[model samples]
Target: MALMTTRPWKHPKTGIYYLRRAVPADLLARVGKREEKISLGTKDPVRAKGLHASALLELEQRWANLRCGAASLSEREAHELAAPLSAWWFDQHRDEPSQQTFWRTDLGDGLWPRRPPGWSLRPAVGAALIEEAADSSVHARCAMEDWCSEQADALLKRRGLVVDETDRRKLARAVAAVMQRASLALHAAMRGEAVDVGQTLVVRPAMPTSAMATPPAEMAQNSLLPISLTALVEAWWREAERTGKAASTHEAYAHAFRLLVAFLGHDNAHRVTKHDIVRFKDHRLASRKRNGDLVSATTVKNSDLAALKAVFGWALDNGRIIENPALGVTVAKAAKVKLREREFTAEEARTLLRAASDLTPGRELPQTYAAKHWIPWVLAFTGARVGEIAQLRRQDLRRETVAGYPEGVWVLRITPEAGTVKTKQAREVPLHPQLVELGFPAFVEGGRGERLFIVPDVKGQIAGPLQGVKNRLSEFARHHVIDPGVSPNHSWRHRFRTVATEAGVSGNVIDALCGWSAKSVGERYGSVSLKARTDAIMRLPRIEV
Candidate 1:
């Protein structure tokens, strides 16, 4: 008899565990699903069990909250109820006095100091002046009144709390007061003076080393050390080992943390807070690149904010910290300005195809031979990302039988076995007749090497060499196409989508061919078979270059 165990269901292909639950009959229509298969994202059975329980509880809470409907609170109740948040804010900012700025606002007659446009205030004073300001000045504050107004919604969402517009305003004002008190205390500390901002301003004493549950020796070797930046990042990287994420992803996250440490002049991640992150963001935005342009908001959001959220979220889930400080912090991207069409024009596509097809063999590096001669055609026909084609292996191409086709279709399997696939799901793209006519099968059979394009490392990871070949391919394409708006390689993706749709290909078939994620729950129910993909592949019109 098989051993009986209570464990999360393991995925056959990915080997990751999932929390599989059937939806309650009444909720089926509401959720638009009869079942929920949430990924635990871990291969370890022990870790999967813990993650499964937490995920199930969270799902249950969400359903409960949905059934309960929106709850309301009085404005006074909202304001008074924000006391704990105020205390938490104080605790985060109390020791960081130098990070605060004090502005003078007159309460009498409501007339503030009149200053020139864009004028900034700077003061060089000791404890005496700061204390005098705290005592005599009407309100020692920063721009938190306006800041809180903007952040109120996100703040409420982070705490899983909700409020009406009337109550939200009251809550913002209460938060503003809390921030002002902390700012006052910070200002005082800047000048070597201490100011009392009531009971909430109290900082907790550190626990004695001897009294801690975990011994120092064990804590020293713990990869989940909350205070050590390196430890935290390493822990996240280890957890992501089997996640099908790119190696460059780990490097980017590690680099983001390094940048943070350099800016803050410390590696103690536990000491970092939201205010520090805000300050760093402001500094980053104010700085410029080598081209003398301000860093784009999208870059900061994707790189820094994304890194912080991932690492801190991992730390919190593993019980390294009580909360993720990066939560509720975000940079809004500016509206994109249109220049030209993103997709390549017919003439541009023809130019690239003709150039790629005309490339003489044995002239360039042996590794980039496939990238130059074949990858462009592959991308043009399939709409797969350049990386996906660039990382393809010679063995990935095979002939598989289909229901309608007697001879079967030649399929190119885009699998993580080649490298990191974006969706972490293997997909079979049928070779377009145009590609087979161009002798793609002969090219695959002719190669003695393992990979069709780039070389892999000792550990069989192709991320590093994969990037190099991709760059070389882009450089080759850039020589033929000179559009500023259209990417050298990515334009193929856009162009293929247009050509495929124009050829009467189904959206779901196109998604399967290109590895694009399904847009709806209903779309995820069934698999897009090889027969369907072959039919769609035949529909794609050949580029007459």
Candidate 2:
């Protein structure tokens, strides 16, 4: 039998080519055009099958290439291509494969392919493409956001809503929101109309130009005007101090100035009239210090009136004012009274001494009392001022024997370096026995570098001199409800003088021991020997607790 050879043939109905071998009538009928010749370049079935497979592979590769080309056209590029191509004039210069391709069509000679007329992008389409590009890239997005923020700030400035940089930021955010909504609407409109998708909406920014821009101008030139009564007084005070006025005189001037400042505010200085000064004097007479009893009208007229006169005089000299307000002011004259010195009674002195000895530390009591409870007793015994006690040093203690009596006494030597004395004269006071027993040596020895009294350990470490001792004693008096007027620290001095006099010690000897000037015919009578002074102080009756 003869072998049948197969050949490749194209099917007319399906428009596909296939290998034909062992040809069946029904299959041949399916591909209608029967007279069509099959060509595989051979009459062999095996060779025709290999050729058909190679053709299929080539078709697959062509399909893949078309798909890749379509994918490479980005959303931006596609929008550009679909719109009128003239809008892409800017994009044609951009460094992109799509841009390059478009550029070649526009700029290249016949060497490069020319884009067909219908293929170019329109202006709206190009704008849409740019907007799309802005959204896709970080740099473009930032630029767009910045533009929106700046536009919002300008609007706020124009509307006078920009109070500060903070307000500007808030306005920018608000503008951004508005711009975003407008952009979305524009985008939607363009999409519906099949116009450019990349086009972004941009609104013009407003600028501000008004008087509010430079800040409100001064309503009046009153800022430079002098308004201070205090300033006027201070000007006078400076001149007085410059001329070396006495401190007491200057202090009186200050007190008057304070009263004037209180009556008339600092701003009303130039406007004050003579009537105002008179009214202030009247007010002072009606005022009282601690009690309901008013200040004497005579005192107000005399002392306070004199102080006000000085202030007005200074003000007149310095050109602060044209006239002295206190010039014609009259004060009531005070009657002078003669009074005799009264010493503490024996019973009162004994009660005070007993009170001093019985003193004990309590809660809320001063640290001075807590640390040195015997200080008040020592003061009662010695009649020493707080300053004298604080200024005592270890070397100032002198031990001696007089008439078979041994004595341990600390002498208070007041030099100008030690500070101002009450009488401004140097004198020595004897230390009492109670002071020695209360560890006076520890304080004197430890504080040899400075004053004797160590600052009590208090909150805030407000360490200082004899001021602390005085303050603590005042607190003690108040806590114990002791009549402050009768039993003050100075009262202790009076008690000492009275007790020594009562003990039959001579006034001259007592004066020497207590640092008092003797009231006698001559200065020679006041001067007692150191031995006699010590003897007199020792002979004073010691009341044991």
What does candidate 1's lDDT look like per residue over 1-545, in tens digits?
A: 22223358887755766666776676565544455555565678898787777666755665665455565766655555444444444444456545423322232222223555643443434554577467544343223343355445534542335567776776776655554555555566678875665654543212212111112222334222224676678878987876756777887789789888888997765566777888888777787855355877887889988998899776654445434667767898678888988888999988988988898877766769778888889989989999888887788999988888888789999987777787888999999988999998888888878888887878877877887898888888878897668888898999889999999998999999999999999999999888899999998888899
Please give the lDDT score at residue 92 for candidate 1: 44
Q: Candidate 1: which pairs clash?
A: none
Which lDDT tens digits does candidate 2 get at residues 1-545? 22233435644433333433332343333222222122223334565466655533433343344333322223343222222222222222222222122112211122213355864566577786577566534343443445435444333322223144544444444444443433333334434533343453222111101111110011011122323455555656676756655444555566666777776764444455668777888888778854255877776776777777876655543334434567667765667552433334555555555565576756643445532354555556566665555444446555544454454455545532454344446666555555566666555566424434444344522224345566666555444434534544566677777788877888777666556655666855436665666666667666654
Q: Every model's Cα RMSD, please?
A: 15.9, 42.1
Give the whole-model CA lDDT for all candidates, comma-separated.
0.69, 0.47
- Give the local distance difference test score of model 1: 0.69
